[model samples]
Target: MTRHLIPLLVFVVIVGFLWAGLSLNPREVPSPLIGKPAPEFALPQLRDGGNIVRAADLRGQVWLLNVFASWCTPCLEEHPYLVDLTRRNLVPVYGLNYKDQRSAALEWLGRHGDPYAGIVVDAEGRTGIEYGVYGVPETFVIDKLGVIRFKHIGPLTPHILNEEILPLVRKLQT
Candidate 1:
């Protein structure tokens, strides 16, 4: 009877852990980079590989660094909001073209609409590794002094843009 009871208790504990994990949202996973200086990189521009976009060039302003790939479906979902934000000109949205062929990324943006102030080609994914990118469609909000204020993993929804990203940008701008 005692041996049977020990196994039952172990099973119950495992079930409890599973239940707790299921209750948590993946999107809310905390980023360690927040409030820290953004990792710097100098990469070729997507449109003209000869031209470079360095992280240092954007130091004195609030900007959005969107990490996206042409193959990502969620990137397409979040694109319209990015376009809208660009039109509003609230902040300069910079694109990090991660792990994609240059021509494919160019075609995707041209077809969707080119919404970035400038696009950086992360073709080798070295920049993505520096930023600790687990997947495509991650975004970072960087303040005037080059500190990463927030990171949004996955795609940005209208609710997330309005409620979190924009509000944080506004606060940082002033």
Candidate 2:
């Protein structure tokens, strides 16, 4: 009887773990880089390969580092919001073009709208890995001192921008 109960107890433990994992929000995945200095990188600008954009150059300003790829479908969904954000000029938005061809990225931005103040190409995705990017469409909120404050793992919707990102940006700016 005790031996039979062992399997049932293990099943219950497994089910409990599964339930906890399922209830957790994927978007809220905690990043280790929060409150830490953002990884330093100097990548070639997407449009003009001759120009280099360095992470250190963006210091002393609150900015958004949006990691995206031309082939990412969710990035398309978030493109309009990013464009609107750029138009508002509330904060500078920089694009980290992750593991994508320069032509494709440029064409996609042309078709959608170029929202970034500057775009840096990371064709091998090495920079993305340094930034702890799990996939494209990840966004990081870097504070004035070049420290990462927040990380959004998915597409940016109006609600998230209004409720979370904007508020954080405002606070960080001050």
Candidate 3:
């Protein structure tokens, strides 16, 4: 009877922990790199394969580094917001094409819309690893001095753009 009771108690404890975790939002997973300098990379441009884009080149201006892949369905949901932002001319948005074939990416862009100021091909996903990307469609807001200001883990929504991203970008610009 005593041995059976002990196992029951341990199972209850494990179940309690699982219940607690289920209540937490997965999108709120804290990134250790927040407020730290963005990891730098120099990757070939998607549009012009011969050209390279260095992360360092974006210093002295507030901008966004959007990690996406041609295959990511959620990225399609986020693309329209990015396109609107680009048309508004609010801030320069750079794309990190994570681990996707160049032709596929180009075709995807053509099918949807190219919202990036420049797109960098992360062909091997090494840069994505350096940026601590948990998955595709992560976005980073960097300040004028090149520090990562905010990270949004999922597809960008109009509410998130207005409530969080735009407010932060405006604050950083000044």
| Global lDDT of each candidate | 0.93, 0.94, 0.93
Q: Give the per-residue lDDT digits (tens) of candidate 2, residues 1-174.
A: 999999999999999999999999876668899999999999999989999989999999999999999999999999999999999999999999999988998899999999999999999989988988986799999999999999999899999999999999999999
**Residues 1-174, model 3: lDDT tens digits:** 998999999999999999999999976779888999999898999999999888899999999999999999999999999999999999899999999999999999999999899999999989998888976799999999899999999899999999999999999999
Please, what is the TM-score per model?
A: 0.87, 0.87, 0.87
Clashes of 1: 0
- Which candidate tops lDDT? 2
User: Which sections of candidate 1 miss by over 4 Å?
Assistant: 1-20, 26-28
Q: Compared to the true structure, candidate 1 yields what TM-score? A: 0.87
- Local error of candidate 1 at residue 17 (angstroms): 7.1
Model 1 agreement with the true structure over 1-174: per-residue lDDT tens digits: 999999999999999999999999975778889999999898999888899878999999999999998999999999999999999999999999999998898889989998899999998899998888986899999999999999999999999999999999999999
Model 3: residues >4 Å from true position, as ranges?
1-22
